[model samples]
Target: MSDEGEMTGGEDRPLDWANEPHMSSVDTIMWRGDTDRRMRGTICMLEIYDCSPDWDRLVAAHEWGSRMAPRFRQRVVDSPLGAGTPSWAVDPDFDLHYHLRRIKLGGDGSMRELLVTCEQLAMTALDAARPPWEGTLIEGLPDGKAAYFLKAHHALTDGLGAIIGLAQLHSPTREHNPGKPQPPSPDPVNIGPLDLIGRQIGDEIGRIPHRVDLALKGVRALTNPRKALSSALRYGRSVPRVAGLVSPPGSPLLAHRSLSWRFSAFEVPFTDLKAAATAVNASINDIYLAGLIGGFRIYHEKMGSPVDTIPVAIPISVRRPEDPAGGNRIAVGRLAGPVGIADPFERVLTIREQVRLARHEPAVDIFNTLGSVMAWLPGTMLMQFSGAASQNDLQASNVPGIPWDTYVAGAKVERMFPFGPLPGCAMMATMITHNGTACLGINSDGAAVTDLELFAECLIAGFGEVLALAADDGVEPGVLRRVE
Candidate 1:
């Protein structure tokens, strides 16, 4: 599951984006949940470039990218009754000036300053009235370096979906190519919540036959009552785990919640992470989670408040090959992080087994299965599920990155760090292996991770312990270095 997704499209064909007129139930939950700032589902990507892209060309690229993927120009319209998944209508008055921005770095021209600026940019809530996304081309870094921060609502796309969009948006060469396809802008729409109600009702009615078919299938299952009962019992038992209702107890050390966020960035050679994974005979994600828990272990010991285990959540991709590219098709997998294990290999092995079991849950697809119905719930009732993520100390995601070098305008992208939204978790970490480097973007809840400096050091050391497994191969475990 940690294997990266390859670039599978060419310029001749349009991107296989999610072009559905309405948001999926899960997307609806994220879009509406923004009412509670803590539940903001904004995902961001930060790219460090060799130099600032030609401003005129960069602007043209965004205009081109927006045209290639119409969702960028579309905004959500909630159902008039505030029930059911919302509709996506193209903005008749779409303005590129509003969403695209440029700024000069104010502090010392360092990665720390850049990421801190990004932290503030990320923490500020997106405007719900317009498209829930923004882009800033940050100039004035050292060595003529520049960074671009693009923030989007999780409802717009998941990690993988974002990758698909990025892959299309970026170029493989420094030189401009005239062969790139030029897509026409999308047609404007004049629709709102009132206009969506009738369509929503019809869509609900369209599912009546499927519900009846399911009922009929259940009736038929009665002929094999024993088997049906066993299956039902197994599914019933799996529901709690899949829903995260029966997960590891929350660690008191991470009990605090906050309105503010802190950011840290880290990276290492992809080979180092791969070597550790191979040494332990575990998936990359297994090693990734182990390293994170290992850091928590060191942090707890250093802080003098040790915890045995903590609630962790991972997004398991349920996206099938046939599914469209620009929407979430993920199931949440729960883990009881192995903080008590002192050995990194042991922690990795424990996580491998936990992930194995989590992946096989009978109700692993419960989110998507119930999303359609849940999206119709009233605001208060729908929000009750938001607390599930709050119980997690960490939420981690690993996305396979583009293996080849890519360029934006004429600026080469050195590395791309992905930051997932906190969503009440103490921390959210996302790693994307870009051009042989694994760039990690970490966001910590300000109240929970009070000592971010010590936290960063503990993280590097924690990963160092795992990378030590490659000692037999003569690899320097120090290859697991922090970027900022």
Candidate 2:
């Protein structure tokens, strides 16, 4: 099925174009295929649910979907006609017909089987494109269940922004609502050569002196015993408070990933995770990683290969509310997690402490700042090298969701699972809590983590164990322990 319609192009703006190394860094390391042209990140997945068999309602979803393409599509007007160092920004030119795809899974396959097929298909879509985004609605799974799969370039929107964009198309109430007020779609401002190049000049000039000073200070600190001692003390004292900024630990030896991908999901009630955290006085994020650790530990043990500590990466958003409107404002933090711990509670507590140390470490912020300087390298080289580097074992993130219930074409959104990239890593696990439900999306590499289903099961079971512990004692005592 397809919805064909004309899409009005948004106003054109001259984009600021320059070959900044860091800007290229995102392009090189993140992009997966032959051409850098596909820099827009893709968030693709298969959603399974039971829809009423009414023909009219099914038709309406396709019809309503047409009006939505222009809202979410992004266009880059200034991309180099030939493959080159940089591609400038522009508003996406969305085509409803081109973006939305529909196919009926044969009656022979179950919903689970259909989902597996979709995961393999998503992996095949490694190439990039302009105005980058695509969607497919797979209906007619076994037992009256259907699925919706969507992929949008990472450069276009982050997890939170994507949710907001999707919410625009949904009806506010259960009843069919018409003439719904459309959101204020911001106009694209073209950043041309003069604007982009001029700004780059100023930024570069300003950073020169600071860079020199830091370089000198770094050299002096290395040679000066007194200064080095003071810095070490500072690092130790600050580790606990900013531990949230670092990565969780994982084993260095991980399963080998193939070119193909596999997707899996499991449900853990928000109440269960919250209750478990309460039992241990940990935050939702802490509990979340604990579940991941439990899953990882089990995965390793089952394979007869386990490690005491493993390195994990956590993305820390540097985009403050008041920062300028465009470009990437995120940094990566590396932290170690103790997945080898046998006791679930002990592992949770250990992770909580490790995270605390990472959040408070001054080096976390310093490293991010340092990365900006390294961003001066060319995009192609960065991509070539980093792409070859070992992929992180898992990418785990929790994004905040809508406060109230939301509906899409009258289908009550019972759950929202966010599927992120599994690039170079074993898998990417993203969690979003909609209303009262915690929807977990796991995207695993086919070769490395073959048993994603089992991994997800462990996450579900680990949280259950933690909640049981919490039921016995209130969270206050655990909170008090950290305070003291």
Candidate 3:
């Protein structure tokens, strides 16, 4: 969103990130839940470029970006006792040198080796004291190519918001634009833990009227007791499904969870994936889940630990066109993945129906509805209280990408991969279609996926099955390739 109170199609504007001083109840949980090391909420993005952007220009771009979007210069200050939501305050000790880093690969400098470095970087937790984000420029690839890695807390902004934030900072063309507007740095605000607690108190006090209004609604509904009772029962039945209190059959093989993380990359043509989805009369999301679930089926069969179904989790975006493009605006949706289904078309069909039902749950918005009350709970107990995603084997998300070409400093971005956090899940798979390719970044628990080689092969073959469906539509066969 622009500072002028409206969003321009593609013009420069202040981002709608961290605009508010206090964190929302939902973001508070995400930030505090880091108490459980296994449920780190770090999200990362890796972008490959045709060539290394000029170092001087790159630094200048970030400096300008920090001023335009002050959230980059802010840090999370929790309430005194972690009893409530935190506040976003400008860091008094902000230092660009600490957050921005540059490194060069030493080995053959293959994409595979680069990913290994990324995995190590991702495994290192960000300092909660400082602004919960960092960036690195990795040079020395096979050609003149380079890559950039950006990691931030999930409380900062979601995958979609990150792209929006990126679009504002990245240049539309390779050549430097001397006439770009410069925005002043946001004034520093001294916000401490005690102040945050008071802010939380004020927010809670502010919600009394809403609560009272809801209570009055209930009282009025009692006049039509039968209708009210039916609505209450329907919502009550859906609460478990939305909260993940109900778990589906699990795969014994992917049951383990650990602190160690490993990374794998894959890409498929967007056109082909969409075409295949259309061929099956399903949405792209269904096809994506089917391919992922199909891969699990192949992997389990190969590992001699076949299962009929496994619990799958996907984020159901609750973001609206009028909502601010910041933080998370999503709810969890669970599915009983049909791994037993041998046919790709059948798997897609089954997944499509399951997704439809999950979205239509009477209480699909339960989390957001009760986040205020839940946020009051101490951080230490949030893992158990929040019904952690640990019960699921896979957590996947699909985010719309920046459709046009973009450059940072002077280098044009080639492929953009997003690695989502593994909040107790065996794997977090995120797909973002950059340009025409759907770049899939999978962050797996090191112990859960013992055989990375086999896992990658199975995923490729699984996607191959789904992509074949497009052949009947006169679409060229799309090939899913493992990125190094």
Candidate 4:
């Protein structure tokens, strides 16, 4: 597939730093959740390949792209007394080199060594005072191929939003210019603590009329006794269901979590996964989750500690067509991982049904409603709530990515892997489909998942089990088989 039609001369566009973006309520929760070491930060990696571009040209391209998106040079500023959600402000001492790092691997520079470096990068926390993002250009691959690792705060943007922002710095073809550069932005105004507090209080006061209107609506609803009673009963019934969904039975082995993390990456043919899903009459996400459950089962069995189910958190994107590109616009969907199901096909069916029911449950709506109210909460209170909410055995996400060949600094993007935040979860497995391939990035807690190599092998075997359903003939699917 070619992205020629989607190509635009975005490089020439000037950035408007004056129009700064603020963190949404959902984003604020994620930001505050960083207080806990177990759920510290999130990072995403994009791997590019082929001819290596000149160092000067690569740095120039990044600088030009940064001018197009002011957020690249901005940092979060909290409101006084937690009166409002955090706002984005220009970083006075912003330096491109600080965020854009260039490193060269020694010798042959195998993928293992590169991944080791990436693990180190992932473990290190981003400097809070600066913009919450960094890009590392790693050179010296075996075949002169290069890879770029871009890491950013989860609070800045969700998976889809991050991909959209990255697309601005890439091209449909190698011989094209990146985003246009604009004049340097002016320094942001320095506001005193009292002044900031006063402004936030005033902003809160301005919403009095709207609050009163809502109160009146509540009173009117109460006047309709029958309607109010029915609504109350519905809410009352949903409480237990939501509570049950939140705290499901999980494996004891994966219960304990720590701050240490390990990263793993693998690629599978998108066509085979799609075919497997079609054959089983399930969505791609269903198959993916089934594979994860299978892997978890295998890992536990190998350790002589198997469990029936595992709690998994799935983030559902709620971004609308008219919504802006960045910030968090998502809700969580909890699933009871069917680890006990031995048959891959049956596992997929079970997952599809569970997910269908989860979507229909009122808990999802309640979760989204609470997400919108998180901005009004005090920082500490918000952190406590977020920390409790993020407790799950595992998290799986399927983010659709660029479906056509893309270029970054004249190099073809070989693969795109996304590593999401652990968020107190034992493991986080995220998949993104790029140019007909599904790339999976699995991040496991080092303290909880002790045997990394065995866990990785289990995951691979689990994926193979599902892929086997794609073949009509009675032939077992082996490791690394060609899908097409």
- Best prediction by lDDT: 3
Worst 10 residues of 4 by lDDT: 1-10
Off by over 4 Å in 3: 1-13, 387-389
Clashing pairs in 1: none
Tens-digit lDDT track for model 2 on 1-484?
Answer: 1111111223232112111222332332243323332221457644444452234554554444433433233443322322222343434443456756677876466645665767656655533445556666677766565566777666544565555445544444555544432224334546565655555556678779998997898888889889888988887655432333233433544647666666666565677677777777788888888778776777778767887766666666665666432344555555565677878778888877876755555755643454444345545654454444434686677777665755544455555667777656777788878777677777777777766665655555555555556665653211100000
Stretches of candidate 4 off by over 4 Å are 1-20, 80-83, 106-108, 178-191, 206-210, 223-227, 236-245, 365-368, 371-373, 376-378, 472-484
Candidate RMSDs in Å, in order, are 3.1, 7.8, 2.6, 3.6
Which 10 successive residues of model 2 have the least lDDT summed?
A: 475-484
Q: What is the C-alpha RMSD, rounded to one decimal, of candidate 2?
A: 7.8
* Residue 148 lDDT, candidate 2, scale 0-100: 69
List the candidate 2 regions with Cα displacement exceeding 4 Å. 1-41, 45-71, 77-94, 107-109, 142-145, 182-253, 323-328, 363-376, 388-390, 453-457, 474-484
The TM-score of predicted model 3 comes to 0.96
Q: What is the C-alpha lDDT profile of model 1 across 348-394, one tens digit per residue?
A: 88999999998998999888988889888886666667765456899
* lDDT winner between candidates 1 and 2: 1
| Per-model TM against the reference | 0.96, 0.73, 0.96, 0.90
List lDDT for all candidates, in order. Answer: 0.84, 0.56, 0.85, 0.74
Which runs of model 1 end up more than 4 angstroms from their true locations? 1-14, 472-478
Rank candidates, TM-score, best first. Answer: 3, 1, 4, 2
Total backbone collisions for each predicted model: 0, 39, 0, 3
